[model samples]
Target: MSRFEKLSHVIWHCQYHIFWVPKYRYRILTGAVANEVYRCIQIYCGRLGCEIVELNVQPDHVHLLVKVPPKRSISEVLGAVKGRTAIRIFKQFSNLRKKPYWGNSFWAKGYCVDTVGMDAEMVRKYVKYQEQLEKQQEQLQF
Candidate 1:
């Protein structure tokens, strides 16, 4: 049997982080945008057969921690999330639909993803605390 054929019993948790285009910057990622992204993420995860443990939408990027079944690949899950969010964002924001919000691409090609083991508490905490950390960094800039 091939690896694809193997019936592995795995509960995989993954984190996906992706950024926006350069000129658009993080400014476009407001509370409204974040809420839309969050809603879209939930719907997309359901469609992809993944369980979203948590999600944090920052100014520059989005952090999603999801639990995927063994049959699913990490890349597949992230791609779904990114693709759906981008489409929804562009549709909702007419300005984004105009030239140059994404520069032909709604999201940067590269992303960061990490696999978590049984010890998922740390990862969960980090995801939950991401916004707080960003706020602290912003305060320090003053």
Candidate 2:
């Protein structure tokens, strides 16, 4: 009946709209790379007990709306997602690691995040809409 989550000590509803780009903002997150990124994020979120409301992986950056529990800091969630995704990306796509320019990193140093208190639906639609727009643009390019 309630969107709030219950912990042993608190009832909370924490959602974040997070965005981050690849190192150097490279446009390499296409095709298999994008798929892998999604898989990695899902797994990491599940492991951390976070709920993903929406996610989109563009060629340069990622858009995620997640419901994180109060016990976890946003930085902690971001670190886990970024760190795990990077390691898996390098392992699965070994060519990326071979590139000297990548310089031992998959994501950049910082990310942008904002809390979603009331406009949750709006943000969710925005994420999905962006993905659709991206697909349409891709079709026109081909």
In terms of TM-score, the best-performing candidate is 2
Mind sharing the TM-score for model 1?
A: 0.64
Find the 10 residues in a row with the least total lDDT in model 1: 15-24
Candidate 1 lDDT over 2-38, as tens digits, reads: 2121235653344433333323354566678778877
Residue-wise C-alpha lDDT for candidate 2, range 6-115, written one tens digit per residue: 99999999999999999999999999999999999999998999999999999999999999998899999999999999999999999999899888899999999998
Question: What TM-score does candidate 2 reach?
Answer: 0.81
Clashing pairs in 2: none
Candidate 1: residue pairs that collide: none
Give the clash count for each candidate. 0, 0
Structural RMSD, model 2: 15.5
Tell me the lDDT of candidate 1: 0.68
Per-candidate Cα lDDT values, in order, are 0.68, 0.95
